[model samples]
Target: MRVRPFAVALMTAALTPATLMSCKPSSPPADGAQPPAADAGPSSTQTDTAFAALSKRFLDEGLALNPVSATQIGEHRHDSEIDDLSEAGRNKAIAWNKAMLAELGKLDIQALSRENQVDALIMRNNLEGSLWDSETMQSWAWDPQVYSGLAGGAIYNLMAREFAPMPERLKSATARMEKLPALLAQARENLDPARVPKTHAETVAKQNKGVLSLIDTFITPNAGQLTGEDRKRMDAAIETTRKAVEEHQQWLDGTLVPNAKGEFRIGAERYDQKLKFSLNSSLSRAEIKQRAEAELKRVREEMYKVAQTVLKDKPGAPELPDAPTPDQQQKAIEAALELAYADKPGREEVVDFAKHTLDVATKFTHEKDLVTVPDDPVKIILMPEFQRGVSVAYCDSPGPLDKGLDTYYAISPIPEDWTDTQVYSFLREYNKRLIHVLTIHEAMPGHYLEGVHSSKFPSTLRAVLRSGVFAEGWAVYTERMMADAGYMDNDPLFRLMQLKFYARAVANAILDQGLHVDNWTKEQAMDLMVKQTFQQEREAEGKWVRAQLSSGQLATYFVGAQEHFDTRKAWEAKLGDKFDLKQYHDKVLSYGAPPVRFVRQLMLQEPIQ
Candidate 1:
């Protein structure tokens, strides 16, 4: 989410005595005579005042409608309310967006400061995206993840943090839980079984079941703290919510799964629209695919060279190939990747390994002056069960309003029931060096670092309307940046692992488009992952499921990294020797997580697109 200029202005007004002084009377007005009726005519300050007022109203009203988002961002005002999942609710959101857009159109962008112009654009894009999602995309009609996420996040958000007293939060959780059954009922009423995709149904089923973990692990333990009446009510609500989740799971398995014959693909037309909204970039889908394809090849070739370095002395290692065939490249790359895979941490040590890696990455980041490391604390924790099966690792940053709070670097442990092969595949894919890369991407200079900087941007809208591309792109970019800086003494294994991640980024774009747009089969997708990117079978299979389960998101990594790379190159060209990597990074992130295109315009003083 982008920051709102009004919040920034308010913070400035509150903190800067000079700003307050400037607003006061320059001299006493005739010992009690009115301070000379304030200058009411149009002025630069008036423009800011007008925009700030509009920005705040827009944000405040917007948050009211999207209470789930409000809660996620650490705003407690609507913690007890569940999002309206009814048809009327959808219409209301659409109407609200329309009204906001109309109001935004009235703002004089040219009259506003550069920062406000950026804020206005971010707000406009967000509103437009929302309208598009509701009207054209109609995800509510087909996507079960929407409801499941709300269901799970409703309780998870309240329980995961100490944003409020535990009892207060528990009270809110009970309120939300009491409403859970109806929300699930609304999901059944709202979702079109004929339109629901099988992958979505399966994923949501898993998530719905996982919600019980929240009750068991967090809510149940804390319920004891409540007095008798409150405790009884809370217990009853939990029991009811658990039953609702179980019933939903049963429906998912019995009814939804059987009827989920719909295609997961949004097709090219919707994909293009949604992709534009998701990326907020000037590059077209074709352009992104072109860049990704090139990068894929380049990264693969680089991986081959690194493989050659790692395996040069090993007997029977595949001969160094000068322009090897795809099969030969895969063979060689896998051979070298084994060196990293051989050093895997025990299953129990994943979190500890990530913790140690965070320390090392931070130390190297500061020692090399990569970017200013914030003193903001970060902790490594197991990903909650409900959030599992979506992605293996994530950086769960505190809401922008929840500054200085601990950011969770969540690593999903291997499922206990997995077969030996599955376990091996998981470990090999996340090999020790790659875990370092993961730590760099999810913590240190990745999401956690960027999030900390974004929280201080002073604009609520900017923090709320954060660009996924910028966030994911910066994280992906850091993997390469760290590798380029010779972290781990420039070990070929680490560099190989870094390049593999780059390949995965490229593969992500390819897999997303290929599956959702090109209708690539699981075999074809797996071939690309295993053969081209050297992903293990289990990793490739999980990615296949993920690709089916999502769209456009996978492309963000490659597209965003390219934008970051291009922006850096342009800045370097413009500034010549004056360009500094650390300064550039700090400056880029200083604007919060606006789209890279906006960042480029701001950095270069170009017109906002």
Candidate 2:
């Protein structure tokens, strides 16, 4: 149920299924089955060390092929690069993942200490299963996150960072152009037409439009500067892709658009496999459904109390208010955003605000002796073009391998040339819960500072298996954590309103997965957001679309937060006066973002590396 607006970048425009993903050609794993190997020689601890080194190699391959991921993690080697779309590059990555898996599978997990063994097994299964999913699941074929994120990263990296020189940027763009035709062709060939989710196809169409705009706005003029044959080559390449992109759009509108036949659910079989590999356990579908429903109810009661606290001023706020009219809904959403962000400064003012937020929170945390603050400072960057066309904001952590890199609390600006209607639509949608809860999620003792410590973890495998649950959980947990820390010490209303948004995200995880995988209706989903969670219309609508494209994600917020909170409570009971906040936080983040279960084990005096 963990759903968040931001993770990867997204594209805007219709696309022919032909123009599939632009990077990581390594196709998903072959058949969801792993080829068995004899257990490695020696004990569990030795095996864990071998597997950790193996996973590091896998991460290196990921960075080499997908440079944008590297840049996000603070790797500058490929800062101005776009990945090769040729079959050769894709095949190489695929081969690399496979080989890494083979080498890793040879290790014996039974020999390692419990904590190291847990991480080892998670890393091993993660790599092998991911390799399987890469080829078999065909996630990039229609998953909007895959498509949008790939394209979005391209745009954002080009626009957002000045990490590389202009020449390097232009060269990468030029090189990218040369690979476009082949890239599109391979995409079509590798992506099975039958597998795309109807939701994915539709989302991609809209996402593609935004991506196409980049060519006219950024690439054409930028690339036009190259001399001689290079200029001719780049321009011709651009023109060719431009025409192809139009055809791609036409294909989406005319063919895939009309013929898209996809189901949001992966069915019980694939879902189980995903639970095993992606989540690092054998959690059954029934188990997740049960867990989701239980959490849903618990979060709802919390939301109701929060709503009463914040919206008591609104006459008969109707518990949850999804306006029947779109306009009314949009207005409600707008009002919600305004309420949540009452204390924060605008995007341009956020860096200072980031520091100030930490200082303010640290003051209380120090006084109350809550969790300790991370030592490294973080900065807020304006959202890059690559990450545009999606959420309002996200906290981007530095890469595991990179040193002295800044953590980015990226805030996306409104599109500069948009019409007033569009601008207002965006603001209206981003209303209260969206902004306030996100601030707590992305800043303060949330992602930015947390990341600085996570990046320094000793376990390389632990770093790679950064749990989406823990990452999102910690962020969501912080929304409440701040309130408890007296975030709006002066204005309790702000704290209450923020809780409503946090609840909305909590509901999102349940409703998102329920709708996609369990046949929950839109009315049901909307009701949860409006009445139970208090989402504004525009934000709620966005959530609907986001939920369709995403499943098994929204739950990370509540689940991770709950686990984090529980762990802290346990530590306090165990250590009493010895449970220093600084030591506690440092300990929690020390194992990187492993699944909460693994983190729990690590916290119980278990060996992580």
Candidate 3:
């Protein structure tokens, strides 16, 4: 579950375009996935042999670098062990990326098949800018011990969530959990106090604070269910593990935070370099920022139009504050939210609705031509306690490497102590704006569809080349697609809500790159989200925090979506009447969720390696 095809700093969009693409493409008259040719580097015969060898070496090196990923993916070639978290482990990866890049450059990408060539380009990109992130950009410097995916995958391996059966899975987990403390100890040692990011340090300190909250809430109450002496041993292990996590948290707070001295924001040069290698997009950073800014202006006007459709009947609902002016927007946004969910039922009703919505939403995928639906039903599970503060709702799919388990549309419960007004206010913001959008993005034809397709993408390189820019991009694309396809059927209010979600995506791109790279203020972030995205104040507040905690990620939804749509349209227009939604989606997703650059080449039957 923690396996990353690429060691992207956050998500794929965070990647810098030049860093992502090595074979330069001149602008085609009509755009396609294939980039312009590199200066005829080498003859095809000479390059293909070396390129094929490069692919195997890279995949082998990647797995060796991330053993936990191998175990999580059901490869189980190394299930008995965990990763060494020492400085050596980190350095080995850096050296591997450098070596891989050097080997990749020895071959000519234009000589390979379109798909293999794309893979090669991705390899070059992942190695170039990605190396800077791992070596120097030092995001881990801000927050090093964010290993919940490791912990979460430990549960995933034990549970029958993946292809693993109950006994084998559980046995592996038990062994790994037994060794977890040593791994955590290594994490503590290798993770430097002096290099930690301040905000990252703070957030991680808090998340770790919730580590023991896991035992208090789940394990302590359920320990007795374990079998015989196994139960006793497991109980003892959990307690020790819980204490270990707590001790680490104390070290983080008492030792690390006080001395964590790294710059919170990556300086412009580092950010630029990271962006170039990571994104692999055709556009440069300034170009992406410019496109995002233009999108911001366009989405703002579109947001007002959508809000008018939803709130035409409600007086004072048209009031939207300016992106440059945050306070006024915050107050107005709060008021619109108050009006939206004014009739919301109790908290139980909200949770119950989310459950039902998943049921209803999943049914549509199979019944409609929207996409090829999954046979394994998507599961709408409850959110784990340890992951609550980040967001109230998220869709967690089976790891692309794993198969068979239901993808969870996890929703957090509202706090029991809130007054009716506060509950209503929160529910109102979500019910109309967030929930349905999340449903489409996470479940039907969004992450769920992307998750399955990613599992099938032929190359490990393509999988690593996976872009949040593409994944969230595809999901957000669906928000608009579903509406255009008449989702919720004739309910303009829902469609209006859909646009609001898009507005959020567009604004998110602006907020993330702008805030971290440009040092935009809280007011600046909030105002843009609320005024331009039509996001409620509470929603904007949460998104702002999410952008900070996760830099370079917010751009994925909007940028990814646009690339998917644009690429599909180019192919369709080129395919000229041969286009079918089912066919297009099949071809588009069949290559897995790589950067649009790679996906275009794959769909057009070109090489990536």
Candidate lDDT values, in order: 0.75, 0.56, 0.60
* Model 2: per-residue Cα lDDT over 345-419, one tens digit each: 443443344445555655665576666565444565667765565666776643444444455667776656667
Best by TM-score: 1
Which wins on lDDT, candidate 2 or candidate 3?
3
Q: What tens-digit string does per-residue lDDT give for candidate 3 at 1-609?
A: 111333532212222322111011112111122232344344654565567666666655565565565544334655655655456766776777777877777776667656557666676766666567666765433455445445444444444344554445444555666767876676576567777766666766776645445445544555555577666666667767777777777887788778777655665676566556555555566766787788766654554444444555676564553342444444444444445456453577655766666776677665677777766665667777555534457766543334344556677777666678767667776774457666777767777666665556445445444565666677778788877777787565566567666777777767767776898888887768776566667777777766666655556566677777778887887789777887788777776566776677666655453
Clashes of each: 14, 51, 33
Q: Which stretches of candidate 1 lie over 4 Å from their true place?
A: 1-44, 380-393, 411-420
lDDT score for residue 414 of model 2: 60
When summed lDDT is taken over every stretch of 10 residues in candidate 2, the lowest stretch is 15-24
lDDT of residue 392 for candidate 2: 67
- lDDT tens readout by residue for model 1, 396-471: 7666555446667788776777777766777877878888998898887887787766555555556656677887
In angstroms, the error of model 1 at 185 is 1.5
Off by over 4 Å in 2: 1-53, 60-99, 110-119, 140-159, 192-194, 215-233, 281-288, 303-369, 374-376, 384-392, 412-436, 606-609
